[model samples]
Structures are given as C-alpha cells and as structure tokens.
Target: MPVEPDCIVVGGGLAGLACARELACRGRSVRLLEAAAASGGRVATDTVDGFRIDRGFQVYLDAYPEGRRQLDLDALKLGRFEPGALVAEGRRLRRVTDPWRRPLAAVRSLVDGTVGLGDALRVARLRGELLGRMEAGGIDPDRPVAADERTTRAALEARGFSTRFIARFFEPFFGGVFLERGLDTAETVFEFTFAMFALGSACLPAGGMAAIPRQLASGLPADVVEVGTPVAAVEPVATVERGAVRLADGQRRACRAVVVATDRRAAERLLPPGSLPATDAGVTRGDKGARMVAFAAERSPIGGPTLLVSADRAGPIDNLTVPSDVVAGYAPAGAALIYASVRPDWAGDDAAAAADVLRQARGWFGSHVEQWRPLATLRIGHALPDESPAARRWRPTGPRLAPGLFICGDHVTSGSINGALVGGHRAAAAVDAELASG
Candidate 1:
C-alpha cells in the first residue's frame, strides 16, 4: 500500500493548487483533491466552435502582488487591454483615456464633454493620492478597515466627484468589477483596485483565464493534484494526531493535516457547524451572480482592444469586449469574438438573454450587430463574494480552524485572484508551522 500523504488539500482551485504547491516546496508530501473534472473551480474556459470563451468576462491585473509572486506571467504571454474604456452615451461612444497614460485623448474627452473639467482634475488628483497610499502600504487586505471607512459611492462623493460623473463613468466601470452598480463595496477595496489598475496593465493570457490554474498545477508532481475526487467531509481521527477526509466514494484518506480550499458554499458544508463565524455562515446571500454572452462577428466593431461600458440604463448589457481584438488566439483566423456581460436577472432563458443582448448591441454597433452569431451564454451564479461594507466586516478569516484542520479561499482574504492565492499561501504557512511544532 502507498504511504499516507502528509497533507490532503480539498478543492483544486487556485487556493488549493497554491496550498499544495507551497507544501510540496516545503518538502511535505501533499495530495490535492478536486470535485470537478478540471482543476479551476470558478476560473475556467471552454472551447466553442474553435472560439476560446472564458467562463465569464475576467481580466488579470499584472500589479497584483500575490499573482506576481505565484504565477509565471512571462510564459503565459499576456495580452493587454487599452488603459481606458469607451463609454456608451446615447448612440455615440465616448473614448475616455487615462490622463497620465494618454494625455491627448484625455484632452479630447474634455473637449467633447465626455468628462467635465472639474471631474477631470479630480481624476488626476485621485490617481496621485491612490498611488501614494499604495506605496505607503495603505491597501493591505489582511487588515480590517476602520469603522469610519466609507463605501465606494460615499468615498467618491467625498472626493468631490460629481454625481453625473459617478453615474456615467464610475458606476458602469466599477459596477462591472464589483458585480454591483450601487458602488457599495468597501472604499478600501476600491482604493486597492484603483491603485492596481493605475500601476499595472489589465491583461489576458494567450490561452485564456484557465491557463492560470493550469500553469500552477503544472509545477506539482503528476499525482499531487487529483481532479474528479470529491471529498464528502473532513473528519478528525480519534486515535491519531492527524485528520481523515471521507471521500464521496466512501473511502477515507488519512493525512497529517487537511485544508479546505473550496468556495464559500462548499467550505461551509465540509467544515464543522461552529467553525465559521455567524457572518460567514450562509452562502446563498452575500454573493454576486453574472452572465457572459458571447457572439462571433465577421469583423471587429470597436477596432482596438478597449473595454466598452454602457452608461445608458436603457440597456441590459453592462460591459462588452472583443476578446479576439485583445488576443488573436481567442478566435479562429479572420473571425472576431465579442463578450458581453449582463446581470443574471436580465432574462428568463438563454435565448431571451441573447436576444436582449443583441438588441442592446445594435444600438452601440448599428444594424450590423444583428449579423453577429450567438455563440454561448455562460452564467456564473457565484462569480464573487459580496464586497459591500457589511460583507467586508466579515472578510479575512484566518486559515487555521483547528489543530489538524484549516480553511482558505477568497472569503478568507479579499475577493480576487490575488486574494485566493494569498489565502492559500497563508494556509500553507500555518500548516507548516503546526506540523513542525509537533
């Protein structure tokens, strides 16, 4: 019989992969179990008729500290989007570029009334302030925000941003990021996100978002990461200092430590009833859902790789991007791929949702939008955890839940790719320390 592993990590997402990698690096024999056929939990990609469509419209910020530390970025050959976005105002599209990066375009925006002079100046000032704070280490997600910290909307208002500007720009731009148009996410998260965007490029790997997890998994031993292995529950061993994970197949595997790195819902079910706090207990609430509607086009609409956000409340689409424009590998030769994001509540079914999306796209791209072929409608029910101020209060739960049991995920840190990796690294450190002490 094969000897028992030192640790068994449940969940083959980024957190679980990172945890397993860190443990193996520390010279501990580790095994990672994933319930799905693939390693990436929420971060996945699918091939539809030669088009590489990610599970949703997602991007990776090069400046994410944890990502920089954990990922081999160069190998992924990332493709970057333009620094600014094209905002849909009525039938016309207004190009808004970052003043620091594209001064000439910023001037054009001011000339065309895309952004008022006052709001333009405030944007410059806010950029500098956020950069300075980031340099001073003011954007730590591990630390709790002050009780007086404001919401993203409140912070923008306090910073003298006009309500019109907030609704036209910040709402749709960041609303797509936080998955909420209210802009009620914590101000600290907003600050960190803004700083990262200002400091780095928003990019996609050549292979797609799934390439990230695949790269992480590639570094480990072939047998270390096991997909299609569903763990039923994590139970403590009565006669040993180790723990045992009961598999869905009724087999129990013993290990020195067990780390639950699944999503909030799965983690809650596998962990003991009282292990998590009351605020993090329920997963049905305090989660965000989104859908990605992909359409194949004969040619590019916007031309360049710029994200487009809908400022008009008259449309159901929040944002749209041509992935093939950013990365040619996203689609076949001579073809283009467009992805439009909408709230899960947009329509009753995929057909209705796709029709509504095309109706809105026609307004932005003219009648030619009707010619675009519908590819896929991907819906993510729990795309991200709640970033609201109330939800932020319960964020950053620790990794060590007991002597032989631990937990990690975006919920244990901030909600992002960086947060998941940070949680995994922290859990590995805690597990290493505990095992070494004994």
Candidate 2:
C-alpha cells in the first residue's frame, strides 16, 4: 500500500497548492496532486525567438489587497504599465488619465470635442451614483449583483452614457477584460473591477505570468509535493482506515481531511450530488469572448505611452499593453514585448477573428508593427463559477461534508488568486479545529 499522508489536496492550481502548502507548514504530512504536467493553470507563459510571452495580458493591480498579504511579491520581480491610456476614437487618439493625477485629463476629455460635455458629464454622474449605491449596501459584493439584467450597452444608454464614450472607453477597455461589450453584465462585476482599477493600475511580473504560481510552488516544503499523480476519485465518506483518496493507478492514501480544489466543472464531476452549492452558482456567461493572443517582437510596438483602441461602442478588441518597458527582462536589450487581446463572438472563427483584430491594430500602430511578431494565445472560460439562475441552490457550511471531507476553490466565495489562498488557509484551519475538538 502506498504511504497514506495526513491530508490529500486534489488540485495544484493556486488554491490546491496553497492548501497543500498551508497543511505542510502546520507539520501535517500532505500529498498534493496535479492533473497538468506542471502547476499554475491559467497563469501561463511562454518564451521563443528570444522573447517572453505570457498566455494573456496579466497585470496585477497594486491595489489587490489580498495579493499583497498572501504572496511574497518581493521574491517575484514585477513591472507596470504607463499611468494614462490613449483611446482611439473616430480618426483621433484621445488620452484618459487616472482620475487622481490627471483631473485635467478628465476635464479636458470633456471638452476635447469627442463625446461632448453633456455625455461626459452624464458618465461622471452615473459613476457617482453607482459608487453611492455600493456604499449604501445596494450592491452585493460577494455575488453577481446586477442592478438589472440588460446588456452593458443598454445599461449605459439607460444611464445616458454616450455612444462615443462607450465605443472609445468601455468597449475597448472593460470589454477586453470581461470579453463583452454592450456591457450587459451584472453591475456588480463592473463595480468590483472598476474599484480595482481605481485602487491602482495594472502590473506584470519581470519573469513572466508563470512567475506567480512558480514562486508560490517554490516556497512549499519539498517533502510534501506529489507531481504527475492524478487523483482518480475522492470518496468523502471513506474510512480513515481505507484512506480518503482512491487513485486510478491502483493507489490508496489515507488522510485526516481532503480539499477538492479543482476547477468548478471538474469539481462537479468529482464531488457528490449534494457536495457543491450548484453546478451553476451566481454568475453566468451570458456571452463569451475570443482567445488571448500574445506576441514577442524584435521590438515593442507600444510607445512610451500605452495605446488603447475601441472601434465602436460594441468593439471587439478592448485594450493593448507593452510590458517590456515595465519589466527589464521581458525582451532582449532594446527590444520589447506587446500583448494584444480581443473578445470574439461565441461562434466567431478563430483565424478570421484574429485577423480582423490585427487589422484594427494595424490602423493604429501601422509601420511600427513590422518588428513585432505573434506569440502565445490563451482563452479563459467560466473564470467565475457558472452560477445561473435556474440551477438548484445548496451551500456547504464547513470544511467537512461528512467527518473528514472538505472542498476549496475559486468557486467557493474566494475567486481571485488571493481568494484561493484564503480558501486554502480556511480549509486547513477547519481541519485543525476539527482535530482539536477530537
């Protein structure tokens, strides 16, 4: 029989790995299992032709409060994008600065003859109203709390945001992130992400996007890791004598408790009928977006200033960033890396879709594009757990479904990287508490 450890963590992404690390740190023997050849999940990166390319444009806002406390960021060298944004609207490039530093930029933007003062003022007023609602507890921070269910475009139009501002800013900027336009998403997501933006701008790691999980994995005590050992099934009601996990390769390991930290879809397969809250929880993907496309060039196309282009209010391509300037090692000397991402319709063609996006990009950067070349691409689906209205309702109270079973993942309230860490810590603490009570 294979040696049974104190705990068995069923995934190796940020949440699973964090659970394993936390358990090990507490002197509990742990067996961390990963389905992929390596760890990190969507946190992907690649290097080729002497340039580094992340799976997508992953910028860590300095304001993500949880990121600061959980991960030892110093160990992973980081970088940042420029402060302001260059918006491409109707034959002219408009600049939008951070509301704090460039109060003038906002004022000037109102008068720049783009959206006109009336539309701009309407947007500002709507923003204030949304913030006010949030402060009043009208918005639920934990769930998909939309003031109403309408397309983002309809919501903005209802609030009096002009077509120009929607096309220039919302479609290209937030659209790229959420993978939608017409902004029909739940209002709560907009509030959360917008709050993050206001807290601080985006940032990148010097090495690559992989550096984050890589760093987290590195800190774990070596004695606990188990690579290439895929967990076949988890029997939450198993006897301590029989062990908690039943492996596919005819292996059995016993543990005091278990953390099911796989993705929501996969977790649904592994968990019992009543284990999860609902296959679809609070948020639903009303629409989908295209895969992310990254490229490392002999030189970066992004100039000293970051350029963002939105073709129209419902534009597909949202924003663009050049990370080489922020991080020294992203490209070879005197060269830089450019990351471009777009949101294609659910049934959009891949190559054709990419080409259409590229055409739009050429309109802005033109000849400067010669030096840059294509890199890796990534598409994240159901990033937030699929929580649709029709799904049944069920919420697990504590770590154990039975006496020695537990679950953890972004699906559980803590969705972001920080949330994953917190979930892992909570699971471990729950196990500790149960053991103490015994």
Candidate 3:
C-alpha cells in the first residue's frame, strides 16, 4: 500500500474502531493506528493460568442506547448478573431485587428494612417515571433530565430514603460505579445510571470485556486496524491539505482525513495548530482511577455469580464478584474467579496492599478466603472519565479541527463504550460530509 490513504484513525479503542469501521463502510480507504499491543483499551482482559481477568470490574448494560445500535448483543453471547445486588448490612446480607421481577425478594427487602415500605413504594414510583423517560431515548440522551439540581446524596435524602439505607447501600454501590465514595458525581449521571439498571441486566461477554472491542474490530477488514504502532503526532499530509500521521519511530503516512481517537492529552497534541475544543471538564479534571486485586479460589465462596457489596464499608474492599459464575468458561477447571475493588489509598505498596486486602476478605467470606490465591493486581490510570455535570453534558459538534483534521473518543463524548461509539459515528459522519462537499 502507498504511504497515503483517504483517512487515518489513531488509537485502537472503541472510538477508533468505530471511526475506522464507519469510514470504511462509507467506501473511504482508512488506516487505524493503535499504540497498544492489542485493541480494547480499558475494555481489555488478561488471562492468568487459564482464568480471564478483566482489567477491572466492568459490565455491559444492555440498556445503553448507543451500544444497542453499535453492537450485536446476541453475537457476543453475553452472561448476565441477577436483577439486583446483595447488600451486606452488618452480619446479614439483604436481598434487594426489582419488585417487578422478584416479588418474594422485594417482600424480604421490605421486611428486613433494607428499604422502608414508604421508600419502597416511592422507589417503585421513581422506577415507573424512569421507564417512561427511557421510552424517550433511554433518558437524558443529551443531558440530565431530573428537575433537582443537587448531588446524588442530596437527592436521595430529599427523596426520603432512610438514612441507614443511604449509608449501607447508595454510598458503597454508586461508589463502585463513579469511583467516588460521596456520590458527588453529577446528578445527571446518577439518574441516567439508575434508569439503566431498571432497563436491563449488568452483563459481560462470555469471553470477557475485551471481547467487546475485539468483536467490533472483527467486523472490519482484517488489514484496516494496525496494532503496536504508536503515532507520535498528526501533521499535514504533503501539499494535498490533508493529514500525515507521524509515528514514534519517525515514519509518516499521508492521508486525506485524520481522526485522533485517543485520550484528551493525545488529542491536544494531535489537533492541528491552534485548534482546541474548549478543553472539556472530562479532559482537564480527568476521571477516577481504580486498583483491582483478585483472588482465585478452589471453590466459589459467594455462591453463584452474586455480587456482594460491603454495606459496612469496613475495609479497602468495596465489592466482590464471581465472573466465572455466569461465564463458566472464564476460569480453569474447578477454580473460581473472585475479585474486589481495593480503594486507591490501600494500593500504595503491592505486597502490603495484597496482604491487607486478604485479611479483610476473610471477614466477608469466612476462613475460606485464606485459601483463595492472589491472582493479579491491576491499576488503570484513566479508567473512566471525570463525569462532572459539565462533562456528562459535553458532546462534540463535529469531528473537524481543520478541513481534514478530526478528533473522537470517550473524551470527545461521555466516558463509556456508549460514548466512544457515538464519538466514532460523529467522526465518520463529519469525514463523509467534508469529502462530499469538496
């Protein structure tokens, strides 16, 4: 192939893949450049002795409107978690389920005071409202819909949930999702997430989260995506008023269109001279980082693929998940996968952190935790974007920086697979429009 092409897509995560795939489908010659050894970015999985461990605890909510449009859920062969979660309150674990799906669990939840009868009734009303909102494009397709402008903590309080429920449930549960314990994440995000939970199951691809991007890449032409190739900068492509992707190794490939589908830092560097997209909050503030340390047990301790949330919030451990429960092929024969999100404060020293986490795991899973072997300690620096009120509301107007330069990725939209796919589509559409106009 020549050093020049119609378009060049940088970064091999969801957004890059989306841009490349869409451009190709539009009959434009495209080249996808990825710095990593493989695609998927944060949506990656690592295998240890036959057990597939996701980069961190992640799930695919079938309710994401963009995801439903961009992916073939049936082809992914997804495995789902049960409707609700097991909230650990002191020594007892309370079953919290959607009353619409599990009537007995709902009754038990009310009886156990996990949620008061009035609060339960109010939550049901809230669910009905969310359902109606979802019917209008999965609720808040562009911005927050709630009339209240307070934080999640304040909103829950004003809504009349018991103080005990707030401490034991909302704090720890939303903390895992936002990576922030106080629920300071924009109320818009909280409302969107709550609506998603009511709409569908929290699931994973049978192979792993990595399977998501791999599947996306699989549908494209084999030669389109080039992994292990790091792009140093995006410059002019000769005298054609286009792009030249300068690789770290000093090689340059010219193309008519260039999409920098990487992170914010990279986007800033790659954008044409004097082009900036207002420096969005998700770019400046950055998202929270998570440290995950998992343990492999001879037998599953949590019983089935149930997720156990630490209502007490006693230690660095916040939640526990058994991935192999839903996807039997995830673990080696007879071995079960157990993982937890250890607070970043505890991740100062690996050996010390692993020992500390193990000591606390025993309290939750009994003496059996002692027998669970340490699997891996993984830290994702930019796991999810800082979803502040401004960040969630931000979306790209178009993919062009100059006539031929463009940008996309989670940073360009919301910080999720949904956000990335949307970004990709936006870039592709822009490129198609620009080429046709010229």
Candidate with maximal TM-score:
1
lDDT of 1 by residue, 1-438 (tens): 136888999999999999999998998889999999999888899999999999999999999999999999999899999998999877888998898898899999999899999999999999998899899887876456576778899999999999999999999898988888989878988888888889988899999999999999999988898788999988854445678889999998998999999988898888767676667454224688888899999998889899998887776788999989998699999999999998544555766888888888888889779779999998888888877777667654579888888988887777789888998999999999989998
lDDT of 3: 0.78
Q: Tens digits of per-residue lDDT for model 2 on 287-381?
A: 24246666666666656536465554333455667777678878888777776666545344556545555666776778666555666656756
TM-score of candidate 1 on Cα atoms, chains taken together: 0.96
lDDT of 2: 0.64
- Per-residue error at 433 for model 3, in Å? 1.6
How many clashes show up per model? 0, 15, 0
- Each model's lDDT comes to 0.87, 0.64, 0.78
Q: Is candidate 1 or candidate 2 better by lDDT?
A: 1
| lDDT leader | 1
Report the lDDT of model 3 for residue 147: 36
Candidate 3 TM-score, C-alpha based? 0.91
Clashing pairs in 3: none
